[model samples]
Target: MGTATHDGAESTAGDEELVVSANARFFRALGDPTRIAIIQLLLARPHTVSELINELDVPQSRVSNHLACLRWCRFVETERKGRQVLYSISDPRIRDLLHLATRMAGDNLEHLAASQRTGPDWL
Candidate 1:
């Protein structure tokens, strides 16, 4: 067993801090609606920046910015094909994770929706 620190982390210096920072960066990277849309689009297939702009209907610069963020998070990868740079999902596991999250959200939303629809029997 390792020594415990006062902060409930291992005595190993910087390990916990690094983990916290990485987790924050990951969540922050995916926090934006635009970034999530970019991920969903890339999950379907690789697309050039022009293609993405057309499909997403967002401004070119905004899409590019979100693509950069996704790339930094390692969720997106790019290739220089001809004159256009194509972006695709870097990890297939991300698609699986997204699917699982969608199911989980739907499960939760079903309860919320039923509650909202019926409301309180007393009311």
Candidate 2:
């Protein structure tokens, strides 16, 4: 029936909108410099909170807070090694995502810098 087809189309459209919104949120999570740095470190290997603090030269609280955010986003996973909690990238594809993003940013650095609509100072 026409009504059934219309309902199905509406449902599909709604699903697509949800997907787009989720994708945007995912990127927003990576928009933070600290979160991005956390991911970059995890890509190499797992690290403990203390190690991250030492490597990043940030306070323990700052490292822990960002680690929590990364965990909530499912961007990284954790493991227990004796008394230490080690964090690592949740998926291999994340490495590819970071690599591609880096290349894209490099290619568009000029445009991104010139854009007044959005940038580090936009907010």
Candidate 3:
């Protein structure tokens, strides 16, 4: 009985560790604006690293770094076609999250603008 209880506790701890690790990786990957942009672009279609560099208009190194982080987080995947590597979002849920975030941002911006126009105390 003691051994069974110990094993169950260990199993629970392992499951919690896995969940926390996954959550940490996801938030860490999303902590960058550039990375978020990359994910958004990839949500549309796969692209080579060079295409990402051009589209995001950022430094090549920065784009590459973000791509690496995203891949580690399991939010994106890579494929090889000839000498070129393509990157794309691995899950459709990421695209949905991006869309939701965009909508929320837009609503927040509009609310801010309205508040400014009416003054903060204007109820």
Candidate 4:
């Protein structure tokens, strides 16, 4: 028997459920400021955890946790070079998505801040 997907499309229920679950996990991975900073740093080039800790000026444990989350989401991947493991954005599309999102938010940043300060009524 056929089954319904998340969007009510006809498909294998198991496949669609997995896709939706993965997408949620992916968003959760990007949901944090720390992870976003990590992504920003990785945008230029891959970096070791130590380098990330230095550049972001965050605790090593915090950086490690965020890296783990990003890795689980497949937003970033790692490669071992010698003794150090370097982390980098997993997909080309991730960079593009971040760039576009930053550009859009940059234009509205002041307004967004103002809105937050005022209340949800403005929203």
Best by TM-score: 2
CA-only RMSD, every prediction: 7.5, 4.2, 8.3, 4.7
Model 1 Cα shift for residue 63 (angstroms): 0.4
Candidate 4 lDDT by residue in tens digits, 23-70 = 876776776779999998998899999999999999999999999988
For candidate 3, what is the TM-score?
0.69
The estimated TM-scores of all candidates read 0.75, 0.79, 0.69, 0.74
RMSD score of candidate 4 (Å): 4.7
Please list all clashing residue pairs in model 2, or write none if there are none: none
Error of 2 at 4 (Å): 15
Evaluated against the true structure, the overall lDDT of model 2 is 0.83
* Candidate 4 TM-score, true structure as reference: 0.74
lDDT of 2 by residue, 1-123 (tens): 212344465345666678799998898888777888888888888999988988899899988888888888899989998998999999889899988887989978778657777655775
User: Candidate 2: TM-score?
Assistant: 0.79
Which residue ranges in model 4 land beyond 4 Å of their true spot? 1-9, 12-18, 111-123
Model 1 Cα displacement at 8 (Å)? 17
Q: Order of candidates by TM-score, top first?
A: 2, 1, 4, 3
Is 1 or 3 the stronger prediction by lDDT? 1
Least well predicted 10-residue stretch by lDDT in candidate 1: 114-123
Error of 3 at 82 (Å): 0.6
Rank list by lDDT: 4, 2, 1, 3
